[model samples]
Structure formats: structure tokens, C-alpha cells
Target: AQSVTQLDSQVPVFEEAPVELRCNYSSSVSVYLFWYVQYPNQGLQLLLKYLSGSTLVKGINGFEAEFNKSQTSFHLRKPSVHISDTAEYFCAVSEEKTSYDKVIFGPGTSLSVIP
Candidate 1:
């Protein structure tokens, strides 16, 4: 079984402040990790992924995450946040290699960047 956990359900921050979203996962087998962002009334967009590469992965909008195999964690971070960055973020995991593999997503972390 594979599962994802987002420690914080909601994060509030002032504009231009730094923020971090914590995520953890558990899988019985090798897995692929990903972080996705969802804007209001829109589908999710891939933020970053940890397929098979260096632990550090950068994503759009100045977001980045580090894959810690030992801890089974992939925490997303941003140096500075803007009001436009307010959105829901999801952490996901997949155990299969094919594109058709099922992905398990965390409950999602809502980021509220105040102006």
C-alpha cells in the first residue's frame, strides 16, 4: 500500500514571507513522488517530481522540494511567497513505472498568502 500525508492542512503567510509545507509518504515498494498545485476552480498542475534523480528538485514559481529517502519525506518550500501563490498543494506517490499507474494524493495543503 502507498499513502501520502500533508502535515499542515492550511498555512497562512504574509506576502513575501517564506513558507514550507511538510509531506510524508509510506510505500511498500519503490515509488515516484510528486507535488502538485491547484488554483481556484482549476485542475491540478504538476509542481515538481522525484522520479529518479537528485534529491533536490525545483519547480515553477520558485518552489522546491527535497526527497529524503531515509525519512520518506518530500517537503515543499518557497523563499518568498506572493498573494498569487495562494493555492492548494498536494503530495502524491505512485508505485508503478507506467503512466497508467494509480497515484495516491494527500488531503492537500491550502496556502493562504495575505496581502
Candidate 2:
């Protein structure tokens, strides 16, 4: 079984400031990591993912993350943030080998970008 952990519950940042959302996971075997964001009253949208290839992956909205196999972490970061970036971020882990595998999601980190 795989599980996800989000280090912070809420992150308050001023506009144009850099921000990082920490995420960690534990699994018996290799798994895929992902970050998703949700806006007010909207469904979750994929931010980035680490399946294979590069350890560093970039996503939409100037967000990026690095997959650290040693640390079992996939932390998301943004060089600069905007007020519009305020939303809930979730970290997920899943094993793609099987169709029955479940995607475990973290509690979520609420990013409050203040102007």
C-alpha cells in the first residue's frame, strides 16, 4: 500500500513571493507522484507528475517539483506566486502497474496568497 503526507496544512504567502509545498510518500515498490490543485468550487486539476525520465518536472502556472527517491519526497515549488494562485494543493501517489491500484491523496495544503 502507498500513502502520502503533506507537511503543511496551510501556507500563507504574499504575492510575487516564492513558495514551496512539501510532500512525502511511502510505498513498498516504485510508484508515481503527482500534484493537483483545486480552485474555489472547481474540481481538482493536475499540476505535475513524476512517472519516469527526469527527476525535475515542470508544470503549469510556473510550478515545478523534484522527485527525490532517497528522501521519498516530491515537493512542489513556484519561483513566484500570484493572488490567483491561492488554492488547495494535493499530493498523490499511485502504482500504475495495475488498474485496481488506488491513488492515495494527502490531506491538502491551502495556499493563501495575499496581496
Candidate 3:
């Protein structure tokens, strides 16, 4: 079984400020990590992923994350944020050997960017 935790439910940040959304996962078997963004009235979009390769993974809209095997964490970070970046972010994980659709998602972190 796999479970994900997003420590903060809401994150408020000033526009153009650096922000980091924390995410941690627990799984006995090796798994693939992912970050997804969901805007109002929209479906989840893939922000980044760590399927195997480099530890540092970059995604669209200047978002990036590092896969830490020992820490069991994959925290999303952006040097500068934009007002349009405000949305709900989800951390997800699924067993590597299992179906990709059988993923476990975290509650979510709602990012609010203030101008």
C-alpha cells in the first residue's frame, strides 16, 4: 500500500516570490513520483514526474522537483511564482510494477498567490 501526505493544506505567497510545496510518500515497493496541478473547472495536469533517470525533474511553467530516495520525498519548487500559478497541487505515487492508473494522490495543497 502507498500513502501520500501534503503537510499544508493552504499556502499563501506573494507574487514573484519563491515557493515550495512539500510532499512526502510512503511505500514499501519502488514507485513513480508525480506532481499534478488542477485549476478551477479543469482536470489535473502533469507537472512533473520521476520514473527513473535524474533526481532533478523539471516541469512546465517553471516548476521542478527532486526525487529523494532516502528521504522518501519529492518536494515541488519554483524560483518565482506568478498570480496565474495559483491552483491546487497534488502529489501522487504509484508502484512501478503496477498499473499507472492505480495511483495514490495526496489531499492537495491550494496555492494562493497575492499580488
Candidate 4:
């Protein structure tokens, strides 16, 4: 079985401040990690992914995350946030095997960037 758990459901931050969102997962076999962002009334966009390479991965809009195999965790971080960054974030995971190509999303973390 495979499962994902996002530690927080919401993260509020002031403009230009930093933020971090925690994520963890469990699977019997190997898995791929991903982070997606969704703005108000907009579709989700791929933020980053940890495929088969380095543990640390970077994404658009100055976002980054590290994949920890031992800890089974992938945490997202941003040094400075903008009001425009306010949106919902999701942590996702997919099996490495080709049989399952679907991605499973976390509950969601609402990043409220205040002015």
C-alpha cells in the first residue's frame, strides 16, 4: 500500500517572509515525489519533483524541497513569499513502477500570504 501525509493543512505568512511545508509518505516499494500549487479558482501547476536523482530539488517561483529517503519525507520551502504566492499547496506521490501512473495528492496546505 502507498500513502501520503502532509503535516500541516495551512501555513500563513507575511509578505517577504519565509515558509516551510512538511510532507511524508509510506509505500511498500519505491516512489516518486511531487509538489503542486493551485491559485484561487485556478488549476494546479507542477512545483517540483524528486525522480531518480539528487535529494534536493528546486522549482519555480523560488521554491525548493528535499527528499529524505530515510525519513520518508519531502518538505517544501521558500525563502521569501509574496502576496501573489497565496494559494493552496499539495504534496503528491506516485509509484516508481510503470503499472501505476497516477499521482496521489495530499489534503492541501493553504498558504495565506498577508500584505
Best by lDDT: 3
Predictions ranked by lDDT, top down? Answer: 3, 2, 1, 4
Residues 23-101 of candidate 4 have per-residue lDDT tens digits of: 9998877889999999989999999999978999999999999999999999999999999889999999998874387
Q: Which stretches in model 1 have alpha-carbon errors above 4 Å? A: 97-100
lDDT (10s digit) by residue, model 1, range 8-99: 99999999999999999997677899999999999999999999879999999999999998899999999999999999999999986543
Clashes of each: 0, 0, 0, 0
Candidate 3 yields a Cα-based lDDT of 0.95
lDDT of each: 0.93, 0.94, 0.95, 0.91
Measured with C-alpha atoms, the lDDT of residue 103 in candidate 2 is 89
Weakest ten-residue segment in model 3 by summed lDDT: 95-104
Model 2 earns a TM-score of: 0.95
Model 3, 1-115: lDDT tens digits are 8899999999999999999999999988899999999999999999999999899999999999999999999999999999999999999999877665799999999999999
Model 4 alpha-carbon miss at residue 30, Å: 1.2
- Pairs that collide in candidate 4 are none
TM-score of each: 0.94, 0.95, 0.96, 0.95
TM-score of 1: 0.94
Clashing pairs in 3: none
Which ranges of candidate 3 are over 4 A from the true structure?
98-101
Instruction: List the candidate 2 regions with Cα displacement exceeding 4 Å.
Output: 96-100
Pairwise lDDT winner, candidates 1 and 2: 2
How far off is residue 84 in model 2, in Å? 0.4
